[model samples]
Target: MIVKTKAIVFSAIKYSEADLIVCCFTQDVGIKTYLLRNILKSKKSNLKTSYFQPLTQLDIVATNKDKGTLEYIREAKVLLPYSSLHTNIVKSSLVLFLAEMLKNCLREEEPNPILYMFLEESLQWLDEHEGVGNFHIYFLLRLSHFIGFYPDASNMKHDYFNILEGNFQETKTSEYCLEGETVENFKHFFNISVDDISSIKLSKTSRANLLELLLTYFKLHVQGYQRPKSLSIINQLFV
Candidate 1:
């Protein structure tokens, strides 16, 4: 079936010598990988390699085989042309890290319209904003809502956040729960928006600590998940 959808580019890999394999998270089909043939050999093809950059949203027409094999793109165009995400080093690293995270974490092949919308809005917000040091931290927190295991914030008066159970607790149970300063920062992140992300600052040590805590939280909830390789680079950028 030929289908049209809005897709967020998760990652792209070179196929053979002239083609490319692009994996995208689509609104109508969850996650789909498409084969772009021989655009590297033609300057007039209009589907330049630049379009496959991390988290670049695109309107795509493709063959939806749905047989667990790579589909082919009939047409593609940028849905949002970013002004700063690709050019700014800090923002670009954040994008790369987030993209890698999605590549590993997003495994469904069915449509998730809400998740697609959340990512679309978040990426657009990232592109339009500046000095968004805490953007990825906030994004990961919010993304947990859709990916399952969003922290239960109703009982916020507790002393610790139990990562595996996704709730607050007055007593520490194991290595999975975050206590003290990390819990406080997690609470702060839960209440922030993209507009407020830039203003909410973190010391290098605190930021690094929170990131490790978040990764631990993700590993406990997401099965077969591994830490993103770009995580170290992202942490260094903040320091």
Candidate 2:
């Protein structure tokens, strides 16, 4: 079936010299990877290579077989052309890190409107906003909800957090427990808004440690999840 939908480019990989393998998360379909034949060399092709950049939002008309095989994109255009997401050094680095993350963690092949909109609106916000050094961290925290392991903060008064179990606890039951000021920083994001991100301040050390903890949580919950290789890039830029 041919369907037109909004998608976010996760990553584009070069294939067989000139062709490209583009994996995208569509708003209508969960995840669809397309084979772009000779897009690198065929300038006449309507699908420009730039549209496949990490986390680039697009409107795509694609063929979906739903058979666990690669599909093809007949036509695609930038749905929301970013003004600063690709140009600004900080935002671009975060984009790369976040893009690699989506590719690694997101794998459902069925439509999820809630997850789609969360990503769509958030990308637009990132492109338009300033002072988003912690945006990637916030993004990952929220992504856990869709991926099915959001922290259980109902008992936030607890002294520790069990990263593996994702619950607030009064005692450290095992090595996966997080305590002290780190617990406070992690809890600061429980039910906060993007606009409120700037309200909470963390030094560079706190930021790095908090990100590491989040990554650990994802690794425990998400099978086959790997930390993005571009993480070091954003780690340096966000500082």
Candidate 3:
């Protein structure tokens, strides 16, 4: 089936010597992988490669066979040309880490329009903003809403955030739950936006502790979830 849609590049891998396997989350189809033949060898490859960069947004014309086979792209063009995401080292690392996180977390093929929209908007926000230290932390937490496990903020006044139950509680439910400083930091994230993310400050130790709490929350709710190997690198860059 020939289809045209906006897609967010998730990850790309070299196929053979000249081909590439590109995994994308399309606005229309949720997740799809395309096989680009001889793309690296072609004279026009520069444009194609640019579109496949981590988190690049593209308008793609492709064939969706829906036979559980790799799809093929007929043409592609950048839908949103980022000004700073690729050039800035800190922003680039954040994009790479988030891409890896999504590659692991978004495993389903079914279409999720809401999740797609959230990612589309979030990436644009990240690209346009400067000093987005808290972007990933907020992105992951907000994404849980679309993925069906947003932390229950109903009991916001509570002293503990129970990771397993996905809610705030008066008392700790498990060791995974955040308490003391960690809980306080998590609450602060909820009140931040991409623009205001930098102003929401945290010491390096507190940030690391909150990351641990967030990862534990993800593990409890997301099946087969694994920690991103790039996490430590991202943490170091932000710190």
lDDT of 3 by residue, 58-124 (tens): 9998999999999998989999999999999999998899998898789768889888888988988
Candidate 2 — which pairs collide?
none
Superposition TM-score, candidate 2 onto the true structure: 0.97
Ordered from best to worst lDDT, the candidate numbers read 2, 1, 3
Model 3 poorest 10 in a row by lDDT: 42-51
Per-residue lDDT of candidate 2, residues 169-239 (tens digit): 99899999989877889998888999889888999888888888999999999899887799888778755
- The number of the candidate with the highest TM-score is 2
For every candidate in turn, the CA RMSD to the true structure comes to 1.3, 1.0, 1.6
Error of 2 at 188 (Å): 0.8
| C-alpha lDDT of all candidate models, in order | 0.88, 0.91, 0.86
lDDT of 1: 0.88
- Measured by lDDT, the strongest candidate is 2
User: Candidate 1 residues 15-45, lDDT tens each?
Assistant: 8888999999999988999888997787778
Question: Residue 3 deviation, candidate 3, in Å?
Answer: 0.2
